[model samples]
Target: MSNVVARDIELDFLDHDFEFVGSENVSTIDSTYASQPYWKDVLSRFVKNKGAIIGSICVVLIIFMAIVGVGLNEHTYDSQIIAHQNLAPRVQGLESLGIFDGSEKMTTSSGTVEVNKYVSANGSVTGLEDTYYWFGTDVLGRDIFTRTWMGTRISLYIALVAVLIDMLFGLSYGLISGYFGGAIDNAMQRFAEILNGIPNLVIVTLLIIVLKPGLLTITFSLMITGWIGMSRIARAQVLKLKEQEFILASRTLGARNFFIIFKEILPNIFGQIITNTMFSIPNAIFTEAFLAFIGLGVPAPMASLGSLISEAFKSFTTHPYMIIPPVIVLAILMLSFNMLADGLRDAFDPKMQEM
Candidate 1:
């Protein structure tokens, strides 16, 4: 009901309100565009994780040393030098460092005294001054450094073989069972459950009784039941994915059963499979080491981390250094693989991207 009054608007100030600044320099493409292949994205995420990076470096270094370290010393793993038995770690150039100087304490008649083992054992350090036993010698005078790496090599080999076996057998079994569900699935699952019911220790004991205990026997023992876990995982993944839209599309397109499994389904679940395989490697290594520790590992003259630790256990009080290297190596291997698997799991998980 009031009278309307009109005033002159500031049209000149409207220019500043719509002022364009650096528009020509701006990019037209989307800055947030991050489209990449799945594995590339996974690799990028994995590398961003500091723990995974460190774990990868440790694993690679361990593998490299396992391959190259065995021949670095003149002494073979089985060579026995009675006089050099239980020699402390020594390095030619590191003697002045006070560590790894080949010195040990002895309870002489005069009381305990620390003496340079090289000088005491050889009567003179002249010819032996340059000799280095980086990890010292065992009771049998075998080079521990060589044996430690050799043992790692054997352990890695066994784990890889076992995991490979698991992947092949389990992946196939699970794919077949889960892809075609019904009576076949039930029967196959029942068989798997029956096999899984048997304890691993019992199987190993039976194998030990029937066959010679060595690398092959250990590998066989692992194979007997190791695949069950992988198969179960693969079956779960298959069951969850088989009825999905993409799988249904592939099936509707007349894709063969094997084609659907290995081609369509496998690529989708490959990340989980790889993660599971990495996790399994540490278990296999630990199992082998445990078997070796319990006097059922590889026979004497052949060294594994487990056997090395077992041999070192007797003299651990006197020569504690012998146990340190193998224990540290085993710990690092197990921890590194676990970290790597964890990183892979997170990286491959689609939920992580949203998070």
Candidate 2:
């Protein structure tokens, strides 16, 4: 009787172990796993990449500085004060004309007087006294800090708008050519090749000269040639993706070409698109800046990073501070953007297996 009782207890323990293993297998095979869980895992892996995280933080901080730095400070971008000309940056709570007071003297027909002012240096004050320069005024006697911030806004704006235009046209052209690969594809590709053969800088320069040099013209010239590379990339991606089983399944269901190409394929290729876009932004900015530096971008009274650098170049021997700051900003921006592009490529590539 004791032996039989012991045998029964052993069988009961073995049965409990088997039951736990079966439950584990069932949970593993469950098909309804949430997407949020997958995203959390990806985010965790991404945050672990120190360089990528630092690059991302730099980009965010630069953008925030672009937006809020000017408003928080008292300088007006175009303000010129002869009285406050060429004053150094604040030191130990000492107040100067432009940096601290945010006001300057206005000259009248009779004489000079002061006004309780807002929007400093909006062409309000004239005949700059050329005394006590603050932050080393530009040739126009405008505050350097103010002009720098304004230039940031202009450069960023042009890049964003131009890239958006390129993305729209390039994606459309590439998708159409890739989805219907015959005579149409051949013709479109040949045309793009022709555009590619021409030098982009020459095209931009010619456009600037012909159109008389404005922000819009430079942006337009960039888009015309810029889309070609993106189109090629998109078309290649589409060719590979179109052959997948999921695409075949969608086709079997009688889904239209537009639905298959856009809804099915486009979503899958967004990772590539995002990476390309990030890479393209710096290219656009640099090209625009180079052109402006050469006197072919954004005409006078409108400032850009490149134009600011150009202005600095003229006086670099006299005032090294003027040239160095803009150049540093430009370099940092380009490097941050490139790093970010690389990170996106790593994160988004479906074939890339993370360790």
* Top TM-score prediction, candidate number: 1
Report the C-alpha lDDT of model 1 over 189-297, residue by residue, as the tens digit: 9999998999888888889899988987888887778888899899999999998999889878999999999999999999999989889899999999999999888
TM-score of 1: 0.87
Candidate 2 wrongly placed segments (more than 4 Å) = 1-41, 83-88, 91-135, 350-355
Kindly list the per-residue Cα lDDT of model 2 for residues 129-189, writing each as its tens digit: 3332234466566777667767777778866865786589888889889989999999999
As a TM-score, model 2 comes out at 0.75
For candidate 2, what's the RMSD? Answer: 10.0
> Which 10 successive residues of model 2 have the least lDDT summed?
126-135
Error of 1 at 73 (Å): 1.6
Tell how far residue 214 is off in model 2, in angstroms. 1.5
User: Which pairs, if any, clash in model 1?
Assistant: none
Best candidate (score: lDDT): 1
